[model samples]
Target: MTIVRATFLDTPTGETAMGAELRAATDAALRVVDGTIVERGAWADLGGRHTDDDVLDLRDGLVLPGLVDTHVHYPQVRVTGALGMPLLEWLDAVALPEEARLASPDYARAVAREFIGGLAGAGTTTALVFGSHFATAVDALFDEAQRVGLRVTAGLVVGDRGLPEALLTTPERAYAESIALARRWHQSAGAGSSPRTRYAVTPRFSYGATDALLESCQAVLKDVPGSWFTSHVNESQAEIAAVARLFPDATDYVDTYDRHGLVGASSVLAHNVHPTDRELRLLAGQGATVAHCPTSNAALGSGLFPLRAHVDHGVHVALGSDVGAGTGFSLFKEGLQAYFVQQLLGEAGLPLGPADLLHLATRSGALALGLDDEVGDLSVGKAFDALWLRPAETSPLALALRHADSASEALARTFALAGPADVAGVWVAGEPVKS
Candidate 1:
């Protein structure tokens, strides 16, 4: 058992509505045993209560819940800045060919090491990642994640057509391989039968999926309890047009997945930047969550997401690095990007606060992945998936936060200036993975 003493911040109850109260605790202490946080409160209070536990004092630093990423491509790590081609064209030019390289087992393992190490260095403890086309590559990814002790929910990218021949797979092969991988790793345990990973049913997107592929994806999710489904939707003008042309029978882009029984509470769809008002309503009604990949959207020239509208409609939204389309893997930068794009939308944007942005990067993404109960916040019964931020004296963020009179102001400064350099440590399941 261990007791961590630190200044803590998290949105314990989930996203705060605009101008609503944000949940935060200062000078906090967490009591962790068997990889789960058993208690949390003001440091003085918990110190008195848990005197027997070993201590890791981070009292001079800030401890935030480990960031949760809703959408990131494991195979697209190296091609981030190949810019200006929008969605379809960019995929054709660089994304596909780069992803295809993972077909080599050795190359896939090497990239997996880089990708998982990058996530740890950026302080992301939990992520819903898009995996490679090759099942062996996906195997390498899961193996590396376990070896590094990060919480990853990932799967093979299933595509029947509209992708490179090297990346394509028949619907039958997709179903067999996806389900087999799930059987091998989904809800899998370490030595104690305590689960540290999950499997998602992932089809590349509307462009790569035929009706047969999507139905097979639905089967994988249904056949495996606690599994999830994720894919892209309404991301760019050209992608939307092509999807519309491809699926004329469907009413809209969101409908393309909904008709296949894929939209629901456990499913996560990325980049609803161009979703119609009706689609937003359907998403909210169906309890589906959207991963607002603002960096990727802006990078690909995808439209600004309707942040305020989604909030007004009660749609659940989370942040994603969408790495490759997104320039980096840091969820803090993703938070900043989300705020920047919404600000670009003027009055259409929500009354965003730093706490809201933090929540989007952590709790909201955890909720979207159905792991909110286990990893989202610093609440009791949650695992100690957390990041420690220690601002250097020479850093401007330190000076700015020093004068901030409120928690909100200080948190905003943290997001504005605290890049990967400020992350002093990272923990997953009560154990340090980065320090």
Candidate 2:
């Protein structure tokens, strides 16, 4: 068995903060055998013995469940921070052109490596990613994620309309390609003892997919149980207008997906900035999740999300970077932006606390993507995907948040506050990936 000592916080029951905190001034033992958290309570458990195997001495620093980004576009990593513009114009000028480059297998592979590395560096262990349209690009992303031992759910972007011809896929071809990719990746053990890599059925959005294409994408779920379905919803005013013009028979944008059987427990819809009460209720009733990309919303002028409304209505809400459009891959920054965005809406008249932000980044995100059972918490039986945080010596959580530097600092300061630079180490499964 292996033992590591640190100040640990595990979000038991997925309610945000740890119901309890375990602080060991000297040392606390962590038992890991065969890549599982065997024991993690008190130092004297297991015969008062400790093994030298991978003992991470976090000192007084914090150890929490690694951040999980519920929504992000891996192919848009290169387009982040493009000059601000509305959704359609941004897509035309920056987003689409940058994503189109992924057609090159070598380019996709190279970017995949960097994208995964950025996630680890930002303390995100698990993510629901959106890969580029090319099947080879999607394969390249999966390969890189598997090599890095990161838990990722990604899919080939299905866009048949309103996009460059090179990026379009017919309804029939989109279904076939998605099914083949799902069969190849979505499982716990593939070929041998290799860990599972999930595949999401990603229809770029309502505007880009026809009724036939959307139905075909959703139909794949019948064959692949537990597969995730994601798409953009109610993001921009123009997109909503386009969706309305495209599906006039449907009640709203949400209904368009509902007609295709795309709204369900395993569905993840990003940017519900303009979702109506009916749509929110549908999402809640169907147990679908909405990934709140506050930064992207602000960057693309996509109006603020009704976070309080969503939470009050019992919708499953999680955090996302929404990269390129959302800007920044750091969940820490996203968490702070989430708080500010909500505060602007006067959410309870107070900003979200660190625990609230942490919840959205961890358990809530995992639940949104339907991976709560495997990740999001550091329970005894859960996978040891965690981030080790070392706060500056001057502060012990209190001082960090009080003196925030950047918007990202405002969020990271709440947890560690030193910055991403203070992220001392990251571990996926039971192995360390960064330090």
Candidate 3:
């Protein structure tokens, strides 16, 4: 058992409603047994109560819940700055060519190291990663994620058309490979009930995946009891048009997936930047989550996210780095970018606060990936997945943090200036992965 004393900040409870407030504990302590937080209170009070337990003092800077990334590609970690092109063009010219190279296990292993290192280094303890087309590459990703103890949900990227031939797989192959991978990593022994890693049924997007492939994807979900489903939806006008052309009978892009029974409580669709009200209502009614990749939207010339509309429609939304198309692995950058995009939207925006940004980065993501009960916050019964933001003494972020008048201001500065370099420590389930 260990007692962690820190100046903690988080959005501990509630939905991502407007005017959400931070749960700040300037001199707080958490009693951790194994990996779960058993108790929490003021440092002076909790410390006196747990006198014999080991103590981890982190009062020098702010400690926040471990960041959660709902949508990021394991294969695109090497193509981060392949800029200057729109979505389809960039995927064809830059991203797909690099992803195809993962067919080599050794190369996939190397990329896995860099990708996992990037996530851990950036204080991201939980992520819903988009995996590679090759089963070997996905295995490499899961192996590295397990080795590092990051909470990951990923699977093979299956698509039949529109991508390179090497990346394509028939519906039969997709089902077989997906179930096999899930059984190994997600359902090993009786671990399926509470596995550290989980599987996600990832179809690249509607444009690339055919009806047969989607039906097979639904079959994979039915076979793997606790598996998740993720894919792209209405990201750009061109993509939406293409999806419409492909699925002429469907009502909209969301319908293409919905018709196959793919959208649900466990589904996390990325980049619904241009979702219609009908789609939003459908998603909300079905209890699905949308990963709003703000940076990726701006970078790919995808339109501003309809955050206000989604909120009004009762849809759940979370943040994603969408790395490569996005800047990097920092949720702070994503949060700041989310704020910027909202500002650009003017009255159409949600006008987020520091608490809103923090919520989106942590709890909202946990909710999206269906891990809220275990890892979203520092409440009793939740795991000790957290990060310490102790910037270098001489750094500007450190200076700004010191002079901040309130916890809210400190958190605002954190989103504005802090990055991976300022993350001094990271813990997942009470075990230190970085320090």
Worst 10 residues of 2 by lDDT: 17-26
Cα lDDT of model 3 by residue, 151-223, tens digit: 9999999999999999999999999999888878884426532367889999999999999999999999988
User: Which residue pairs clash within candidate 1?
Assistant: none
Candidate structures ordered by TM-score, highest first: 3, 1, 2
Model 1 residue 176 CA deviation in Å: 0.6
Residue 263 miss distance in model 1 (angstroms): 1.0
Q: What does candidate 2's lDDT look like per residue over 1-435, in tens digits?
A: 556666565555744322222222224556666656878776655435554465656755567788999898998888789866899999999889888899999999998998988888888899999888999999998898888888898888998888988899998898888878876787742562234478788999989988988888878766677788888999989999998998889999999899888899999999999889999889999999899898899988889788767776778888889987876778878877887886788734335766677778898888887677777877778778888877556655546644555433444465433346657788887788887
> What C-alpha lDDT values do all the predictions have?
0.87, 0.79, 0.93
Comparing candidate 2 with candidate 3, which one achieves the higher lDDT?
3
Q: What is the C-alpha RMSD of each candidate to the true structure, in Å?
A: 1.8, 3.7, 1.2
lDDT for model 3:
0.93
Compose the digit string of candidate 1's lDDT tens values, residues 1-435: 998988788887745324434566777788999889998777788788778889999966688999999999999998987888788889999899999999999999999999998899899999999999999999999998998899999999999888899999988999999888888888852242227778889999988889998898888888888888899998888888999999999999988889889999888999988878989999999898999898888888888888888888889998899989998888888888888887878888775788888888888888888888898888899999999988797898888878888888888988888788888999998889998
**Pairs of residues at least 3 apart in sequence or in different chains that clash in candidate 2:** 296-326, 413-417
Candidate number that wins on TM-score, 1 or 2: 1
Clashes of each: 0, 2, 0
Measured with C-alpha atoms, the lDDT of residue 107 in candidate 2 is: 96
Which candidate comes out best when scored by lDDT? 3
Q: Candidate 1: RMSD over Cα atoms?
A: 1.8
